[model samples]
Target: LDVPCKVVITAPEGEDPHPRFGKVEMSHAKHRNVSCVSCHHMFDGCGDFQKCADCHIDRDDRSYERGFYKAWHSESEISCRGCHKAMKAKNEQTGPIGCLQGCHEAAQK
Candidate 1:
């Protein structure tokens, strides 16, 4: 797969269009060492890649557990912040992991 060097994630539809933290830029290049499915959990080896919001929506029709917010913030490796936290716990070199850092650093107003 010809993965892009970077992938910027924005808030899902029905959420804040201009989010406080702005967009989260993920480094697919840096993550080349990791399996693609690590982040793209729902991707099948031969299927079209999908946007997270395509499945994890922010509609009030479902529980927050299935909502877009949890998809990104959940304490699971499937989540960006969660993966970083897990790596930190293993004493591995990781990027920022603070509420004001990592994927949640406040964006410039």
Candidate 2:
């Protein structure tokens, strides 16, 4: 659980959790707004972060031997962006997308 570390501000009593967890904040802000796109996708303005295991079952050819947790979380609980950023420079030379492109593709304007 990446709680407290990145949960940012907690909701006041009965304030509504949806606004606090919804895309409006992330779309309009950064840092204080956590971009969840690394593990999620927005389709028709709907955000979905289906866990990796749903698609990566043992019967699947692309399934990893170590399991979804290992494949997705790496050895530690590093976010997907963290892994992408770790390879940003090397990916630059290879012409692959870096962390910036991988997640925050839409530049804040």
Candidate 3:
């Protein structure tokens, strides 16, 4: 019910939790003024769990087709960078780091 909540999603032990594990804090300022339905458009019915790459795949014109990686880094309206830049401008202390340290944490090596 609140933004910036710490959501912990876990997988069964020994299962491959490749991308996600441990704990993550939601974007407090990003979703604070919006409703859940804005993003979870299918909340009213049962359907496949939506992944970012599901609708964010690159266009057929060879513009962008790398899947999740491209989508996450894209500066488009739907991508994380779009809002992260704004957040950073508003507050340097709590602003997002695009993908340098946030989602790409594992890739830092």
lDDT of each: 0.74, 0.35, 0.46
User: What tens-digit string does per-residue lDDT give for candidate 1 at 48-70?
Assistant: 78988898866554347768777
lDDT of 2 by residue, 1-109 (tens): 2323322222234444333132111212323333555434322334454444454344333235444323333422243434444556456322113323323333332
Q: What's the TM-score of every candidate structure?
A: 0.81, 0.27, 0.43
Off by over 4 Å in 3: 1-34, 37-49, 58-67, 92-95
Instruction: Please provide, for model 3 over 1-109, each residue's C-alpha lDDT reduced to its tens digit, 9 standing for 90 to 100.
Output: 3233533322234544445423224554555665554444445545544644355444333346454344444555344565566556777444355444664454444
Higher-TM-score candidate of 2 and 3: 3
TM-score winner: 1
lDDT of 3 at 50: 62
Q: RMSD, model 3, all Cα superposed?
A: 6.7
> Candidate 3: deviation at residue 60, Å?
10
Ranking 2 against 3 by lDDT, winner? 3
lDDT of 1: 0.74
- Specify the poorest-scoring 10-residue window by lDDT in model 3: 2-11
lDDT for predicted candidate 3 compared with the true structure: 0.46
